[model samples]
Target: MVFRIRPIIGDSFKRKERIGNRRARFSSLLALSKFDFEEEHEMNKQLDVHTDTESGLSGELNAAISRRRLLAAIGMSGAGMAAGALMSGGIGLAAPRGSVTEMVYGLSADCGSCVVPATIAELRVMTGTVTGTAFYVTDSGQEGHFYYDPGDTSSPDDTGLVLVSTAGYRFKRIYEGPVHVKWFGAKGDGSSDDTAAIQAAINGLAGGGVAFLPSSTYIVSSTVSIPYPNVKIMGSGSSTVIKAAAASNYETMISASGLSGIEIADLVVDANKANRTGLTVRTVAILLASCTDSSVDNCIVQNTIGGGGIPGVGIALGGVSVRCKVTGCILKDCGVAGKAADGVYTSGTQNLIMNCIALNCTDTGFVIEKSSLSGIIGCTAKQCGAGAAITNASAADVTGNFIDGLTIYDWSASNTGGIQIGTPNASLGALLNTRVSNVTMERVAGSGPSVYARQQGGKIIGLTLENIRINGAGTQGILFNATDILIANCHIYNTTNAGIQSQGACERVVIEGCYIYGGSFGIALTTGCTGCHIVGNVMIGITGQTNYGVYCFGTGTNINCIMNTIENVTVRKIGYDAGTLPNVFSSVNAGISTNATATATALGTLSRKFQIFDKDGGSIGFIPVYSTIT
Candidate 1:
C-alpha cells in the first residue's frame, strides 16, 4: 500500500511506496527522514504524528484521501484534541528521545556498528545491552565509543563503561598512549644526563603506563626513582643501557620505593666501578624497597664496587618487600670488597629469585637474610667468595643452585665458605626451618667449609640439607651447629677437614644416607653434642693419610657428649691400608676415652661401654674395656 504523509497545517504531502512484503514504514516529516522498520507488527497504526510546522493530524491519510484534501481535513477543528487522544494510547509519533534513524557519518571502516545517539540516556541503554561489543560514536562531536560490560560495575563509582578516544571523547577525556623517554627530551647519547628527562616521562604517566626506552645508552648521574604504581619501564634488551655517571654518589642506580605492581625489564644497568675516581660510599645496582608484586626480569646489573668500609650489592630487596621476583638477570663483578659484597641480597618475605647468575662476587653470590618463606631457585654462582648465604631466615627454600670455584679473596677463616649460614649479630634473630635441596658445589677452595652453618648469636632449628654434593672443598665439607637438623642423601668428597662436622651444643641432629670420601674425618661430633643419629652412612678414606671414619669427643671441661647413636655406618680403608689411623670410631674424652693411658680404675666409673663390630657383623670388642674400638 502507498502511504501518504502530510502536515496538518501545510499543504505539502509526500507519498512513498512500501517495499515488498512490508505493510507500513514510519517517516518523520519533522526531520524529513525515513525509518525502515524491521518489525512492522510492533508499530501502532492510526497514530497522530506531529511535525515541526503542524500541531497534530485530525484523520489518518489513507488511500481515499488526496494530498490537498488530506492537509485541509487535518487543518479543521478538533485536530489537536484528536491527536491528544491518539498520543494517550502511548503511540506518540516522535521517536523515543535520542533514538536515531540516520546513518552515522565520518566513521572509519573498522568502526563496527557506529551508534549515534541524540542524547546520553539513549547511549546508556544501548551500552548496557551491547556488552563486549565495540561501537563507534559519530556525528555527536565524539571520536570514540563507550565500551561497556556489566561485570565492571562492581565498584559503586564505576559507570560500567569506559570512553576510549584520542580526539577527546566525552567530557574531553584524552587517551593516554605510551610515554616514551625520547618524547620528554631525553638525549640517550651516552654523554648527556637523561635523568631529568626520564624522570619527567615517568612522572607524566599519572595512573600507570609504559615508559619505553629506545636502544641507546642513557647516562644517569643519580638514582632513577620509580614511585608510581602499575608502571613498567621497558628497554631494548641489552642495547638500551642505563649507566651511572657518578658511581660513588648514589646508593643505587634504580630505586623502586614503596610501590606495587611495578615492572622493570630488558635493561642493562652499569655501576662503572672502574671509573671510580672520588668514590666513597658503596653502591647497589638495583634497590627495591618495600615494594610488593613487582618484577625485575631480563636485566643485567654489573660493576658494583664495595670498598672503603662500605659493602656493595648488585640487587637488594629490603624493608620487608613481599611477593617480588627477580628472574633471568645477570650480575657480574658485583662486590669489589672482600667481605660483605653480595650479588643478590633479599630480606623480603615470600619473594622469589630465580634463573639468575652471579659471577665473581666478593662476599656472597646470593643472600636471603631475615626473610620468611622466600625461595632461591635455578641460579648459578661462579667464582664468588661465597656461593650463597642464608641467615636469620625461616621457612626458606634454596634449591637447584650450582656453586662452583668459590675462592677466598681476603682469607678470613671464619668468613669463607661456598654456602654459609651464620648469625653474625644478635639483631638478626634466629635462623629456623630453612631447607636446602639439590645444591651442587664444586672446587670450593678457601680456608672455610663448603657448607657452613654456625651460630654466632642466634641458634638454628629445623634445618634440612638434602640432595647436596660437595666436591673438592678446602676445609670441612659440611659443618653445622644446629638443633633438629637433618642432612641426608649427600655426597661429599675431597675435603681438608672432616666431611661433616658438628660443633657446639647440637641436639637431635640426623645424618643419614650420605657418602663421604677423602677427608680427615668422615663424621665428627665435637664440643658437647647430644642425641645425634648417624645412620646408613658410608665413609671411604683416601690413601697416604691418617683419617678417621667417625670421631666423637667432648670438651676437656665438664661438658659431656652423650646419647649419640651410630648404626649401619660402613667405614673402609682407614687403618686397613698402610696409614697409621687408629680406629674407625675414635672416642677421646675424660669420660669416654678409648686411650690405653687411662687406667682401668679411671675408666670403670666414667666410661660407658660401646660395642664394636667387624665387616662381617662380628662383635670385636667394647670401647675403654678392650683395646680396639672397631
Candidate 2:
C-alpha cells in the first residue's frame, strides 16, 4: 500500500502546486464520503454526489464533483506511483480501466523529439554473478599448480595452462620435478639425512599443496618452518620418523607464524640423544602463534632429554587467534625431570583437542589456559605426575577422556586431581568461566576420582556432571565448590570421604538422583553457603562418623531441603542444627517449595506474617540476612 501526490506545471494547470498534507486531506475526504457505507461498497460503486460549490450549471458541478471524487480514489489506490501526463503543462488526466494498474504518458517538444520527464523514466535493474575455483590442485599440474624462474628461462614452459596466479606471478610444486636436496636426519636409526629433504620440500612448495614423505628415518639438525595459507606436510602412516640430534642450536622441528589452513599428520618425532642441545632456542615442539585454521593429527612427539632444568613440550601453541585443532596424536616420554612442562599445552581460541593419547609425562598430561570456545574430547592420559588434565583461565568443553595412574609424583600432595579445574593462585578474571561448562564421563577407567575442582578467586558457574563412574580413590569422589553446580544420576562407591561436597558461599547447588555408598559424608554442604537444594539422593551404607544423609549450613530463611532419605543413616554424638523450615512441604515424602514459612498449613494461604514498624528492615527497601542452616 503506497500513497503518492504530484504537482502540475505550466499553462494547463498554471503554476506548479502540490499540497504537502495531501494524504491527510485525502483520508478526511474519503471518511466524509463513506460515513454510512462499508469500505467494500465504496470501491464497487460511485457516490454520484456533488462536492464543489462554485460551479453554476448542473453538468459543470457534476464534472467537478466527479473529478474531485476520482482524484481522492486514485490518491488512495495509486499511493506510490510516479507522475505521468499530470506533470506536463496540461491537466490531461488519464481515465482508469477497471483493474489495469500501469500508467503511461507521452509528451511532444516543439521542433524536437519527444522527451520523457525524469519523474516518468522507466526503471531497469541488473545483477552480476561471481566465479570461483571449486577444488584446489585441479587437472594435474597444468591448471592448478606451476613453477617458473624468469632468470633461467630456457623458454617459457608454455604448456597452455591456467597456472595458479597471485599478483601475476607463477609458483611451483616441490615434487613435480625435484633434482637434488641435502640430507639431514631421521628417527630411530642413528644416521639418515631425510630431515634436509623434508625441510627443502616444505620450503620449496607453494603455500597451498601437500608434501608427501615416504616411510624413512631422517636425522635433523636445523629447525624447519612451514608458513602461510593452506599448506600440508604428510607422511606414509606413522612409519615415517624424524629424529633430532643433541645440540644447543637445535630448536623447533616444525614451527609456524602468521599462517592459516595448514595440516601436519602421520609421523613420529624423537629427541632422545644424549648430546641433545635441547629445544632451548624456543624450547617447543610444533609451535604455532598468531595463526588460524591449522591442525596437527595422527602423529607421535617424544622428548627424551632428562634433567636439563628446562621445560620441554611435545606439542605447544601460544597466543594463537582461531581454529587450531590437535587430534588423534600421541605424546609420550615428553617431560623429563627438572626439564619439561606439559605434554600438550594449548592456549588459544576456538581450539579442539580430540582422540589423543598422553603417557609417561613428568608434569601435567594436558593443560589448557586462557582459551575461548575450545573443547577437549575422548583423549586418554596415563602415568602422569600431576594429573591427566588441568584447565584454568579459560572456558572449555571437555568430555569422554580416560585418566589413570594420576598424581604419581608425591602421593601426599592432595592437590593432584584427575580432572582438576580452578586453582588458588590463578587470576580471578583468568579463571573466569572455566571448568568445562557441560561434561559427561561415561565408561571411563581410572584409579582416582572422576573430577575435582576448587576455586579460590572466582567460582565456577554452570558446572554439570552426568553419568560419571568412579572405580577407586582416596578422597572425595567428586568434590566441587563453586556457584550453581548440578550432579545427577551418578553412582559412586569404593574408598572416599564425601561423594559430592559443596563447601563454600556457593549458591543454587543441586544434587538429585545419585546412588552413593561407602563414603563418610554422602553429600556435605557447609560453610556460609546459602540457597542449596538437595533432593532424591540415595545413600546405601549407614555407618560413619559425622555422617549426614543430606546436610546444609550457613543458610537462613531463604534456603530449602526436601525429599531426601538415607537407607541407613548413622547417628553421631555431635548434634546438628536442622533449623526452621522456610519452604512449603505437603508431607515427609512429598515435594516442597522454595517459598514457604515455618508452622504454616500452606504458604501464602493466610494473613500477613509480620508487620513493619519504625525500623525499615535494613538500610532501605531491605530484608534481614538469612541464617546459613535453615
Candidate 3:
C-alpha cells in the first residue's frame, strides 16, 4: 500500500477526493507548464508509494499532471491579472448596472477619476452617518470634469460638499465656495478697473458670498448692484469673460436690486460696443428686483457693438421677480436697431425660461411686455428680425419656442412677425381682469403654420396649441386677427401658404391633431372667421403641386371641416392654380366624395359631406392639427 506523485520542488501538499461515496475535490498548481515537463513527467515521477492502495494510482497521477499544466499555461495567461483580482474581490464582478452604475464606481479611463477606494475612503469626513456615493462626467471631454476629494475628511468641515449628480450629470456649479477673487488680464481694449474691485466685493460682504472671475478680461463699468442676499458673480467657465463698453451709454454689466437667493453662473456678457444702447443696459444680464428666488444659468448674452445698433435689449426683468429661472441661457447678436431689440425683456411674473437660446435678434426672441404668469420654455430663435417670438403688453406663457429663419414682414423694410400676440396699441378693454389671457403653445416653432394677432378687441383667451411644429417653406400655420384659438397636435411641414390661416375674427376655434404636409394652401378659413372647428386633421399634396385642404373664404359661419383627412388635397374650388374667381361663403361637411367632385369641376361647385372623419375619433393621418379640431 503506497502512494506518491511528485514534482513539488520545495514541497507543498494537501489532498482530498472521493466521487461515488459522497465527497471529493481539492486544488493547487503553481508553475508546471512546458506541457507538464514534456507530458506528465513520467506519470508524475512514478507516484512513489504511500497508502490506501496508493489512492487510485495517486489520483490518476495527480490528474494528468494538472491537465498538461493547464494546456501549457494557455500561452502564459494572466487574464488582466485575473480580471483585476475578480474586480477587487467581490468575486465574479456583478454590481453596477443602474443608478449610473452604482454612482460612478471605476475604470479610471484617465485623469482624476475616483469613486472612493480608501485613501481612507479617499478622504472621508462625515460627522455621524456616512452614506457615500459619487459621479459626474457628463461629456467630460475638453478637460473639464473634476471633483474634489482631497481625501474627504468631509472636505474640510461644517458638513460641506454634497454632490448628487447622476441624472446624467448637469453639474455647472461654477464655484460653491472658497475662491477669494483675484484675476487681472484683459483690460487694454476690453476695459478694466473692476471699479475698485467691484466696490470691494460690495463693501466686503459679511453675509452673502461668491465673486470669483479668474481667467480675466473683465472691463466693467457702473450699474453693478450688489445689495446683498445670496450674491454671486462668477466666471472662469467660459474661461472668464465680460466686456461691456461701446460708448453710447446706458450702463449695466450686472445689477441686482435687494437680492433674494440669487445666482449667475459661468459668464460672457460681451455687449459689442459702439452705440450698443445700454451695453448691458440697466435692466438685465442678470437682474431681479423685489427678488424672490432668482437664477440665470449658464451664460453668454452677446452684442458687443456690431452695426452701432444693438439696442436690441437683452435680459430686462423689472420688479417683483417671482420664481425667476432662466436656464441654459445664450442670447446672440441682438436687435441691431431694426426697432425695439429684445432677447429677454420681461416684467417678471411666474418667470421660468428653459433652455434659452436666441440668435440674430432685432426686436424679439422673448419680449413679454407686462409679463403675466410667465413661462417661456425650451426656447430657440434663429435669424430673427421684427418678431421671432413675442407677446406684447402681456399674455405670456409661450411654450417650447423654436422660431427659424423668418424673412420679416415680406418686403416692407421692417416686418418679421413669426410669433406676435396682441398689440396694435392694446387696450381693447377689460382692465381689471387685466389684458392678455392664458397663452400656451406646445412644441412651438413657427415660420408659417401661423398665429399672429394684433389687438383690435384684445382677448386671446385660452390658446392651447399642442405639437405646433411649422417649417414654412412658404407661410401660414396659424395667422389670426381678433383671436380665440385652440390648435392641437399640429405638425405643419414644407408650406407656401395655408395650414391654418384666418384673416381676423376667430372664435372658439379648435383644429385638432394636425399634420399639413407640403402646403400651398391647406386650411384658409378667411374673412372674419368665426366658430371654426376642423377635427382630426391631416392634409397632403405637393407632387405636381396644387393646394387647398380645407379652404373657407369671407363671411364665414360655424366653419366646420369636420373629422378631416385629406391626402393629396388639390381640390382648389375656384382659384389657386386656375387663377382666381370662386369666393362665396364656403362650406363643407363630412368629406371625400372626391371632395364633392373636386368642388364641382373646380368651383362652378357642389357640396355635401366634404372630407369625412369620425368613425369614433383618432385618425390624424393626413395631418393639419388645429388643436385636434373635433
TM-score: which is higher, 1 or 2? Answer: 1
Candidate-wise lDDT, in order: 0.60, 0.50, 0.47
Which parts of model 3 are misplaced by more than 4 Å?
A: 1-223, 228-253, 258-286, 291-313, 318-342, 349-364, 373-382, 385-417, 420-519, 522-530, 533-545, 549-557, 560-570, 574-630
What is the Cα-based TM-score of model 2?
0.58
For candidate 3, write residues 1-630 as lDDT tens digits. Answer: 111223333322222211111001112222311312223222122221211121111211222233223323321122111111111322222223333322333332211112222121222222221122222222211111123322323221211112322222211111113222331112323455555554454443436656556555666655567777887776655766766544635445677875677777777777554445543333234456657677877888876222334344566566657677777877777545434356766655666666677766655666555555665665665655433443444333322222222222221112334566554444443111112212222222333334465454345555555555655533565666545566677676765677677666667677777888876676776666767777767777787777777676766766656556676666653232222222323233543332222222223222233243457775545422232211
lDDT, candidate 2, 1-630, per-residue tens: 333334333232322443223222222222222112123222112212212332211211112223334334333233232222232353333323211112111111110111111110110110111011011122221112122222232322222211222222222221221211221112325475555556655654453555555566667766668855677776656677767755635657777778888777787877653456444543456767667988889989887433446556777666754788888888887755566556677766777777777777666667665665665666766666544454554333322222222222211114655566654444554344443422333213334445676776545666666666554455777877767677787777753677777656677777787877766777766665566666677765546544655444444334455555564557521123465233423223332333354353433423323333335445323333333222
The superposed Cα distance between candidate 3 and the true structure at residue 314, in angstroms, equals 2.9
TM-score of each: 0.61, 0.58, 0.30
Candidate 1 structure quality by residue, lDDT tens digits, 1-630: 222233233222223321111011111122222222222210011111111122111112122222222222222111111111111222223212122422122222211212223223334333222321223333221222233333333322111113322222321111223445764567799998988878876775556766778778999998888878998888878988999895347668888889899888888999988776576778888888989998889998888878667668888887778899888998888765453477888876788888888888777787777777777888888878877877763333322222222222222234647787767665536777778888887873457788888877777777888888888777888998888888998899888889999888888877888988878788877756767766667777777656777766654122222222232234532212222122223332213323224333432343457888877999989875444332
- lDDT of residue 539 for candidate 1: 77
lDDT of 2 at 388: 46
Judged by TM-score, which candidate is best?
1
Q: Give the TM-score of candidate 1.
A: 0.61
